[model samples]
Every structure is written in C-alpha cells, then in structure tokens.
Target: MPELYSMQFLLFLAAVLICYYAAEKLFPRFQWVILLCASLFFYTWAGLPYVVFLLAVSAACYRASHIFAEPGVSAENKKRVMVGVLLLHFLILGLFKYTGLFRRWSGWVIPLGLSYYTFQSVSYLLDTYNGKQEAAGSFWKYLLFLSWFPQLLQGPINRFGAMAPQFFRSRKFDSRLFRKGLMRYGYGVLKKYAVANMLAATVSHIFTQVDGDISGCVVVFGILVYSFQQYTDFSGGIDMVMGVSELFGIEMSENFRQPYFAVSLADFWRRWHISLGAWMKDYVFYPLALSKPMRKWTQHLRRKFGMQWSRSLPAGAANIAVFFLVGLWHGADLHFLVWGLFNGLVIAVSDCMAPLYRKVNLPKKGAGIRLFRTLRTFIIVNIGWYFDAITDVRDSFICLRNTFTRFRASAFAGDILIYQIPYRRENYMIAAVALLIVFVVSLLQERGVDVREGLLKKPAVLRLCLYLFCALLVLMAFPFAAEAGGFMYANF
Candidate 1:
C-alpha cells in the first residue's frame, strides 16, 4: 500500500528543496527552470504515463492562448479562440477522467490530478482572453504553475492572476521562512493524526456497525461524530498543503476560516472552501445576474411588487442556480447535487426572512447574546454537514427521521455500546480529548488570537516541550498506509 509519508517521497522533496534554494541563490533568473523540473519530477512520480497527458494539455492551452492574444484579432474571433481552448481542455479532461462513464466509447484509465489541473488550465485560458492576465511567455512557467507539487492532487483552485506573480518573484531561503513553514507543517500533522484520524476511526466504526435495530439517540451521536470527522479531515489536508507551500516561500490561498462560528448559511459559505465559492461567484453568478433576461425579470418584478422585491429576486434566483451548479461540480452523483441545493435553499430562505429577523431585535453585544448565537450557529451547521455525510438521499432522510424519533432510556443503554463495530473505549476517549483540544483552539482563533504566535511567546522550555509533544503524537498516531484513507476533496 502507498504511504502518506513514504521515505522515497521525503527524499524527493528534500532533493527538490535543496536544488530550489541553491538555484534561487545562484541563478535567480533560472528559478523557474528549477521549479518546472521539480514539478515534472513530482508528476512523474505519480505515474510516467500521466505526466505525458499533463504536458500535452499544458502545451495545447499555452499555444491556444497565444493565438487568441494576436494583434487585430476580431472580437468574434477572440471569442471563438477562447471557447475552442476551453472545450479542448474539457474534452481532454473528460477523455481521461470521465472515461468510466463512457467505457463503451473509449476504455482508458483516468489519470490522477486531471480533474484539478484541468480546471486550473481552463481558468488560465479564460483569464488571458478576458484581459485579466497576460499569457506566460514561456511554456515552462505555465507548466510549473499547473503541476505545483503542493497543490497538484488537492487544490485551493488558484487562478493565474493571483498565483502567477508569486511564481515570478525570487525567493531567498531564510531561517525565518523555514521556521514558520516547519511549524505550520507540524501543526497540520498534529491536527490530522492526533485529531482527525482518531475521529475518523470512531465514525467509521459506528456507521458500519449500527444496525437498523439501534435506537435514535445512539444514531444521533454517531451522526454528530461523523460531522466533526469530515470537517477536520478536509480542513487538516488543507493545512498540510498550505504549510508545505510556505516552505518554499510560495503561499497558496486559504480555503477555510472559522466556518462553524458563522451565524448563517451565507456566512458559512463565505468561510468554507473559499476558493470554490469565489470561483462560482466570478464565473457563474455574476454573468447570470447581469444577463439581459435577468435584468428584464427584475424590471417586471419591480412593476408588480414595488422596488424592494424587484431588487432582490433576480440576484436571489441566480445564487440558487449557481450553488446548484457548485454541488454538481463536486460529483456526478445526485446526493451531492441535493447537498448543494440544500445549502442554496437555506441561503435563499434566510434572505427572505431577513426583515422578520431584523424586526425581532435580538441583542448583538452582550456575552449572553454571543453565546446564544454561537450555539445556534453550531447546531445549524452540523445539521447541514449531516446531510453531506450520508450515503444517499434515502439514507439521509431516514437518519433525519431517526434523529427526531422519541428518546428512550434504552437508546443510551449498554447494548448500544456493543453495536459500535470497530470502536473501542480507548478510541472514544482519544477522540473526545482531540475534539476538546480542537474546540479550545478554534475558540481562541475565532477571538482573533494567533495561536502559533501565542505559543511562541511562552517560555522557551515550555514551547519546546509543546512542539516535541506534537511531533511524538503525529509519529505515533498517523495511519501510514495508503489503504487508511484520503483527503475528502480529492474525489472532487
């Protein structure tokens, strides 16, 4: 089985870092060359056949963009060029990644990372056509951006306008940068092994073993634990990626903030998977909002129900459609579509009720108000996450029904404990402790405390001890085998 921290992978990263730092110090102009070579090596390490496909796609888009950018190109011609490039990329993506759906047409194994980089490449082509950014003069720089090792498999889905400038900026290997990067990486390791992994084991055990005979209360507990497991697993992977990028003085986008603290579904989307949300807003919502049909509809609504109703209905409908698309993008499955639509509906319903909510005049400042809002937000977010965790629409419906069934003493009985398949008393204890730590840390961060900085301010011995403890936990707890599990967003 493949391992997350294989010795060969570590050796590869070490060699790349050494060469990268050396190149930065010696021939700064050739740093892009070093990055390109390292990226190719990284991609090849996944599989040599896949590397050929990656290069071919990169070369095709790079050349197509140049054609679109030529002098005196008519507006219609430019549009055609842009559309052609995008379609070609999508076609290649479908050929490799979606071949299973069309197995009779073409039998081919989908390459890893193709879904991620395909979107990145299409975004690059679109941005260049829209005049948001210039096409890279060299193919190598474009290639490096597409296959950057830290973001290849799982992505924050970067755009050229945001990431290209940093790729060109020369980086110097400094002690401060190294220290900060290592700390971030270490923090991610602790979050994954010490917290997320343990929760995963427990959730897996409960979900698999809970029979139809289980009582409502025990099922609710299992669902709650599953919610936390998914959150930490996905967010912990983001931390690892972000931390590794920092090591080379390259910063990727931040994907999550304090999402669970959000008071509304709209606010939750703003804080969670921020990159995907931003992409949908820019590419889908804005265009639809400004389209002629929507504008006419807005005018018609204004005539029928005064100005206020007219102003919101058009944009509100657009948001719902965009979020529906957002869900479909995660997978071809109907369950994912329902999950996305559920969020979109929540946002829509909340918007409709805003005037009533405002009239209720809830206090906004005191500790009591803050505590109430925090708890309310946590409950709502967890319910949404529960829908996301279930296997299908029917299962989600049954789970919800079971949750609301009448409580009973037998629901919490010892037999319920026996039904937890792979779970142990030790696993539960460890997961509970890990969750407490996560909650405390999140609370500190939500209050605007910089956790790493605060830790640094402690006495040297204390700080060292904390660091060592985190390292030991990771080494002891990480599931090292490939069969263990993968980052949640990888399937997307």
Candidate 2:
C-alpha cells in the first residue's frame, strides 16, 4: 500500500479532490457517485482482490438493512438478521485475524483493514436493525461510507448516519477549512516522519538487542521510546486521515485526546482510540452489561457488597470482555491477549475504586496534582506497551524482569547507549525538539486551547515559516525507510 503521506498518494488524492469538486459543481446530484468511484479506486490500489470482498460485504449489509427496515418486519426477524450479520462479520474477522495463530494456516495474510471495516459494517447493521438509523437509500452511498478513501485503510471508523449525508450533500469549497486541513495534515506528516520514524531507527535497534546485552536502563529507555513511537505513528496516521476527511467537509470523529494526559487507565482508554472505545461501549459493553446473566451477577454482588460496588460489577466484567476482544482485534497472539486483559483488569480495579476516590477527595485542579496523575498514568501505559511491542510473549516478560533487576543509570552516559544506536546525536536532538513541540501542543490542547487556530491568527510570515519547517521535516524523511514505513496499525 502506498503510504498516505507519500508523494505518490498525495498526487492521487489531489486528482481525486479536483475531480470530486468538479463533479459536485457540474453534476450536483451525482456527487455521491464520484465519491463512491474514488473510494473504490483507492481501495483497489490498496488491495485489488479485496475490493470484491468489500463490495460483497457492503452489498450484503445494504440488502439486509433495507430488508429489516421494511414496515411490519417482526422484532424476532430483525434480531435474527442482526445476529446473522454480526456472525458473518465475526467470521471474516476470525478467518483473517486468527488464521496465523494455528499452524495449519500459517501462510494466510490478513486482509488490509478487515478489522476496521468489519466493525464499521457491524455498527451500521445494528443501527439499522435497532431503528437508530435508516438503511442507506442507495447502495452507492452506503458503499462510499464503507470504503471512503481517506479512512478506508486505517480509520476513525465512521458510522453511516455520521458520514453518508455528507457524501450525498453538495459542499462549496471553503479556503479556511482547506487551510486548517492542510495544516493538520502537515502536523501528522511531521509526527510520522520526523519524530516517529526517527525514533524507529533507535527503537527497533534497542528492542531487537539480546536481553543479556542490554541493561535495565537500556530496557527502560527502549520502552519509553516505544511509547512515543506508538503515539506518534498511530495517532499521526489518524491526524492525517481526519485532516483529509476535513478537506472534503466531512467531519470524522476525534480518535485521540491527549491520551498521555489521562489520569487513570480508564481515562487513558477514553482518550486513546476514542472511536473504538465508544464502539465497544455502545455495542459490546452495554449489551453484555444488560444481559440476563450479568444482571443476576450484579444483583448478587449488590447483596454481598454495597450499592457502589455492585453497580460497577457488571460494567467491570463487560470492560474485561471488551478489552479481550480489543486485544484479539490487534492480532491473534498471546501477547495481545495478555495486553488486553491487563488493561481490562486495571480499568476494572479503577471502577471498583471510584467510590473511595470520591471519599478521599483528592485534589482535582492543581497543576502539581495533575502532573503526578499524568505521569502515573504514563508509566502504567508504558508498562502495557511491553506486551504490545514484544511479539514473543516469553521474551516480553524477560525484558520486563531485566528492566528492574539490571538497571544502570550509567547506560545514559555515553557510547554504551546513544552512540551505539543507528541514529546520530543530531537525530536525537531533532527528536527531542519534536517531542518538546508535541508536549507543548498537547498541554495547550489539554487546557482547551486551539493551537492550530492560534497559529492561524499569527502573522503570515510566522505561519509560513512554521509550515516550511514541517514540510522540510516531511520531505527529508519521506524516502527514508526507518522514518516512513507503513503505519503500525495498518498491519491490523
């Protein structure tokens, strides 16, 4: 797949934008058709054979939802249709996601974006069946929703209700929106190429080092870099994707919300991958929490414990189940499973502790308190990255063990650490500066400041200089393998 930030893909996107706007102006009623065509073309480029699969899934969903939408459809029939649709989605997901987990299917490659699109399909089907949304009136509009090029591969996985109308409606060009989108796009490119990719050179080298060869400090340093690398790459990809969506006058949901600033594991999840978390809460957690067995469990807990403890029980269990699925969604591997459960358990504990937190009346507003909480959450999140970064389950634990036992502050001093890595001192300096920029922006965002809008208000020369700097970073890193490999989440 062509990297979204690459020159080739940008050229393709430019052509699509020009044609899309032309279609809107010249053939107003059929602008949706242009988007549909563009989306399919983009998907075909990404995975040609899978375009048929996408169409099949979209067609099935379109037909099923429409059938369910017909007046006088029995509730039982609607439920069955919903179940069958969900089963089909899970079946495809299982085939691709778990194919390599077993020895019999080691040769299979998971289709690109199967997890993302499948979830999207499931959400749309559920919405239609439950009457929360009407089925798309046209197959083309629905197809465009499923395969929209900007977010087709890695998504802020959209909903039919949120996006379909935008495709059907005509939108005039807005220069201000266009500039904001471009600025956001540039910021994403800067994060991906300049920061994330730069760190990748050192991170990959450190991660692959033999356990015996690296000290605790080295392991800790590697874990920290891995955290930043992940944030930049995954969130950066969303930034670019959302920016593209914005250019088309379609607002995609925000996926990240200064996740690093979260005060607790649950808050961290709320801020990170915000869309996926919302999906799971809406579809998985709510349903599971309200299930008969879970309700009974909650009542039993209420009898044993107090109301506060009992109320969170069902949701806590649902959270665990959701995280397990979240882990499996990432990959069919033991490490991911453990990673998922670890997050679920942490969040559940937090849920159970909510009452105590209120009783203690911890300071909620002071900077000192906020800083402590943020750092605590950051450390907890870094610990979880060990499971995510290490593909081999056993090796991940060993590395974790070594981090505490063999740590040496001297690892940061000289040739033993920084000098031995592939990245030079200058690269590290650049990364530091980039991270500083990210931190400042995140801090501003956390305080409800609009950094982009603020930048736009500055003098024209200042804005031009900043844009040029971002562009330079992107141009310098574009062709470098270490700086611009395919996005990390794109693997899913």
Quick one: best TM-score, which candidate? 2
Q: Write the per-residue lDDT of candidate 2 for residues 1-492, one digit (tens) a residue.
A: 787766888998898788878887898888778778877888777657777668878888988899897888788987887788788788777876676564255453566677778888989998888889988888888888888887766788788888877778887788888888987887787787777887886677766654564577777788898899889988898989888888877888789999999999999999999989999998999999999998898889899997977887788888999999999888778999999999999888888888788899788799899889989999999989888887777878887887888777775565246435766665666667777878898999999999988998999999998788767766665454354477888856
The candidate maximizing lDDT is 2
**Cα-based lDDT at residue 299, candidate 1:** 89
In Å, residue 208's CA in model 1 sits off its true spot by 5.0
Q: What are the lDDT figures for the candidates, one per model? A: 0.73, 0.81
| lDDT digits (tens) for residues 1-492 of candidate 1 | 123456776677778889988988899977767777877777776677778778888998898778778888888988987787788787877665445666456444556677778878877887788887799878888888898877875787888777777888778887666767777776666666666666675555555554455556766776777777777777777787787787788888888887887766788888888887887788788889889999999889999987657766787889889878877676666777788777777777777777778899888688888777767767777666555666566666665676677345464767466654454455555556666767887889999998877876789899798787667666655443212656667744
Model 1 global lDDT (CA atoms, 0 to 1) = 0.73
- Clash list (residue pairs), candidate 2: none
Task: After superposing candidate 2 on the true structure, give the runs of residues whose Cα lies further than 4 Å from its correct spot.
Answer: 101-108, 210-213, 413-420, 478-484
